[model samples]
Target: MGNIQVALMTVLMFFLLVSLHEWGHYYFARRAGILVREFAIGFGPKLFSIKRGETRYTLRLLPIGGFVRMAGEDPEVVEVQPGQTLAVRVKDNAVTRIYLDRLDERSGVMRGEVKALDLERDLFIQLDVDGEIERYAVHPQALIIARGRDTQIAPIDRQFGHKPVGKRALAIFAGPVMNFLLAFVLFGLALLLQGVPSETSSKVFISGVVPDSIAEQAGVEKDDLVKSINGVVIGGNYEKFVEIINSSAGKQISLVVERKGEDVALKMTPDATTGKIGIYPAGEYRKPSAGETLTYAATSMKDWTGRIFEGFRKLIFGEFKLDDLGGPVKTTQVTVEIAKQGLAQLTSWAAVLSLYLGIFNLLPIPALDGSRLLFLGIEAVRGRPIDPNRESMVHLVGFAMLMLLMIVVTYNDIIGLVRN
Candidate 1:
């Protein structure tokens, strides 16, 4: 029962964060005077939706993805021939050559095509478009891909391309920027609630001792606070003491610890193995003043962003395994565990998630904010935008590849869960 609650909390928080990310784009797009058609909260089929002021807010079946559909973002032409269809009147019971328009699946435009009308059966004509024959339905809602010449149906003021380059770029970039902003706010709020730490502790203590390790063999026990090593007092420099321990690999050393208010001396030879320490310091956690909170947040944001970049570098370099990456399943599990830990941890986790999402969205991958910005950049340099059809195709291919990667990651997550 507790697990279920935790999971629900996690999923809710996750969805909220993602929705905010999309909201960023929608906000900027509208602010730029571009019309946003839909602000969907998820992908795939929409389960429910509300329409207001020309924008539809949708809740979809998939929880892991969302999008902001801007007006004229893709090459589109909508034509209607709304009415009941009847067999074309045949002349002398012979096939008639006629032109008809219907929706093209690719371009979403009703295109003109010359086809041989049987007028007896099928009653439809086919037109060759881009080397493929497109059959037009003679009924209502029959749309076709636009053939030849550009036929933009949307008003220039409402089209995304009609916006200035900077505005277009800003709208595209807004999603990731919002993610970063959310992380900062969440971090600051959590810090504010927790209060700032005005004190620091550097006391060195063994929190745990690995079995059969040199420290354990030497009779070292957990909760033993170290006062010095080899006559060298830490002097509140806990890290220096660790450095001394690591540097003395394969050498005999005298360890001095405070055991229950008594100084205990023990001798042991350092292990020759790499990463030899079986001992770990009990970490410190503290808060800072209000002024310090801002500084802390900024510094923490920078540091965490750097860590994300490094993590990606490592993953690319084969230092990280595909299984090491988490998908929605892993995120759900982590979220539940963090929620159970308390609000402070959950807030911090959300902040981290926001940072991750922000950085990832800014990556130069197709179907992402970064890629959209790239297309805009090309338009800026070339003094004209690339063909919308080509651009849309590239993004489509990229989306498919991204979906494949997601499926692979999700599969791996499921396997890991089952094994565990």
Candidate 2:
């Protein structure tokens, strides 16, 4: 059941994220007057489709990646149907005669000899379209590919690119914006739903300290209330407590504690591995407030973005191991683990994950929305568009790289699961 819950949540997250991502493209494309041929989620064979306006929205079998197929998005794959000058109609049943010059718009001009029509599956098999044709499968929502004149050139209008640079940037940035917003809301709601445990030492004081930790070495013991660190008095900021621990980074620090109505000092080095004293204080209960929620949300954004950039830099510098990365399998595993803890815990995890996703997508990698924005920036500066072919090639390469990374991460996820 745990595994099943993980799988279910994984699917839910994938669908929601994919839908939002594609909607960002679809919204901007339409606003920019770019003609979209298809907006699809997932990849591989199509599982379902729905036609709206000129677009064929599809759901594919694989849930890894998605696409927004726009006119002029790919210049290499456009098919040119050869011109036909003949009358094509129902003869006895089959296409029979070739009229090189006769043209029929409704019924395509006949280019070959017409033969007798045969009845199969309760319909006339007239060897052509425009006749009574029976579609094999009934998919009420199957979207037809919009027809475009082959001879007529379809260009991506500059009106999209003509918008004020700021507006263009906003349109380009909305995807990440939405993601960040989701994260912020989730963070706030989590606090409202499940309050953060207060950091204040209880009146009863410390319960236990791990052996060989900073507290043990410092001569700190049970029934001690940590009054202050370094000269700063500890207050309501749970986040700040963590920050001080991390910032100290294994440095020896002075800790003032109140024990049995007497003040005592303890000096110890912070743990290198965990950066904590290993003293467990009695948990304090507090109610969430508007100010606290806002502060938490803002801090979450700052902390998460910092982590993302740090990871990115480490990855680029070869200091970070790819095996430390994860894919959907790991995400679902983590999400399910948090869910088992309770709704508030799950919500907080979701918020943090959303922020991470937002930051990751904004990295100026090719094949990402950020890359498109980069192209637009170059175009704005150069006073001309980048060579479409070259741009396409770069994106293709980037896409291949991203896929390779995903596969590697997924492999790592599986390996970690097995080891555990």
Candidate 3:
């Protein structure tokens, strides 16, 4: 694949994974009766948007990250001063629309100066018009318009923080859960597309030789059975054959092959750099049964999860060096290399990345889902919620620290790429 194609695919993969992750939070928040204000994919400068029900779905310019903004999660307040003029649209004796801009040509809009308003509890708006004071009930689904942008009003009951602790925790935990599920599905699909490896026996069959490789130059044709290597019986042990080849790099080695029941002799030297003759082994794969596919998929997922956990453990214990860490730039570089290996390999790579993303988000770092769950755990233990301001401040600081870390990691990635 060309660099442009690889770059596009990388962006698409990121978008798919991040969108699903955010959707998990969005879906659960709505299920818990919380008002989700915006379901935004990406950040900085909106490229596209539309209002669907109560939520505004937006696609932004940056494709790096996304978010689901639930009401009452942020410390935002709606204030209407006693002397501020406003236009209101009443329906069924309840104010359904409050416009901050000057009145348009709409006939039903009431122009008045605000007296008092209770948007959270009573949902009523008092206004002074022509020296007369009157109060009108505000609809629960009222639209508040400011500068041509409309947002649905969120009452206390519909707010995220006001929801039950269990529901809130579930909503926060759902994102990582979705990532793992996605990884599982992707792994399953990749396995189905690329046949599962079957068991090999005491005889090795040559499936094919790599183009322009030492094995090809030595006339090692497909279907050639390897009888022995360097006068030592291979006994179909692929590992032993690889061990001999690796130890004999850049050195000529003898190979006895049973081609059509006749012994054929060939000599070849392994690549000096990789120590590989580039001959593919036969009977290495078979079409997997449905049960086998599922089993293999689960096993693969578990193995990858364990490996990623070990990586995290190493990093945490200072066993891993700074160069072992990779940020987005490094990820893109890896994706480009994997993209050249065919779709099956790319799919598997994506599954691994998805698993990593899921696990990374579950770490107990502030400004992440895990941290939110941590706060919820504390709330459950204390029988009272933590102060919202303090929690927000902690997340704010954590987010700043994370951004700084990202900058450093990205800089290192760029430097490494340039050196390579």
Candidate 4:
């Protein structure tokens, strides 16, 4: 793939994965009767946007990450001061819409100076109109229009913090869950496209030998069934054969292969640098039935999840170096290389990436779903929520630290690429 093509595909893949993740939160939040203000894919400036019902779906310029903006999740509040002037649309003596723009000239709109207002609990606005004080009840479904954009007002009941603990936690947890689901589906699809391995025999066949490799120099041909390695009875023990070869790197190894009912003895040395003989193993593959596919997919998910958790454990215990971490640049480089291998490899790589993303989000790190759930757990235990302002500050600080880490990781990736 060309560089431009690789970049575009990488962006598209990220978009699909992130959109699914945020959609999970958006879906559950809506189900919990919380007001979701925006469903944005990517961060930074808006690229495209459209509103449907109560939520504005937006495509942003940067394709790094995305979010589902829920009402009351942000600490910043839109304030209407006592002396501020605004326009309102009334329905049956109740204000159904408030226009903050001064140039709004819609018919039947009442212009007034706000004497007092409360949009959350009281849901009433006392306006000074023509030197007469008037109070109008704000409708529960009132719209707040500003700068040609209309957003529904979120009262206390419609806020995310006010929702039941279970509902709130579900909404927070759904993002990572959806990523796992995507990984499972991707793995299943990849398996369906490329038949699953079905080989289980001690008689390993040499599918192919790399040109100029030690195996080729030693006269190892395709379709040769290895009967023994270095006097060890191979007898279906491919792992033992491999261990012998790896351990005997830069040293000659004897091999006996059965070819056309004849025993052909050969000697070869594994590469000193890589400990590889550059010979491909022959294995049988069979198209999986639906049940087998599901079984294999689930099993693969479980295995990969365990491996990812182990990696996290190593990182947490200081067993991993910072250089071992990969960021977006490394991921893109890997994606480009894998894309050259064929669709099956690319799909499988995507599935693995999805699994990593899912597991990584579930870690109890700040500015992540796991940390949010931690706060909810505390609230549930105490029978009351923590101070919102304090929680928001924690997240803000966490986000800053995360950004710093990303910058360092990205720099390391760039340096690694340059060195390579």
Where in model 3 is the C-alpha error above 4 Å? 1-8, 104-107, 198-248, 252-268, 271-275, 278-284
Q: By lDDT, who's the top model here? A: 3
* Clash counts for the predictions, in order: 13, 13, 0, 1
lDDT of candidates 1 onward, in order: 0.73, 0.65, 0.86, 0.85
Could you tell me which residue pairs clash in candidate 3? none
1-420 per-residue lDDT for model 1 (tens digits): 277777777877788789989999999999987878788987899899887766778999988879998877875543324232212212343222222333323242333434343221344545454456556434211222234222222346667988899999999898998999999988887787555432466676775677678788998887788888899987557678878878888888898888999999998877766536577555333656678778878887998999999999999899998888888888877888777755666888899999999988888888988899999999999999999989999899999998888899999999999998
Error of 2 at 253 (Å): 30
Model 2 Cα lDDT, one tens digit per residue, 156-222:
2423443455555665677777678888988888888766666563433454666667788779886
lDDT at residue 92 of model 1 (Cα atoms): 41
Over 4 Å off, model 1: 1-5, 81-153, 198-288
Report the C-alpha displacement of residue 396, candidate 4, in angstroms.
0.6
Number of the predicted model whose TM-score against the real structure is largest: 3
After superposition, candidate 4 runs with Cα above 4 Å error: 1-9, 91-93, 103-108, 147-149, 198-284
Q: What is the per-residue lDDT of model 4 for residues 136-206, given as tens digits with 9 covering 90 to 100?
A: 99998899888776778889988999999999999999999999999998889888877766666546677
Q: What is the TM-score of each predicted model, taking all chains together? A: 0.64, 0.62, 0.84, 0.80
TM-score, cand. 2: 0.62
Q: Write the per-residue lDDT of candidate 3 for residues 1-420, one digit (tens) a residue.
A: 577777787777888899999999999999999999999998789999998899999999866678899999996555566788998999899999998875765577998999899888899999998889989999998988887678788889999999999999999999999999989888888878777656866677786677678898899987688889999998768788778989998899999999998999999988888888989775455677988878877998999989999988899899998877888788887887777555666788888988888888888899988898999999999999999999999988998898788888888999998998
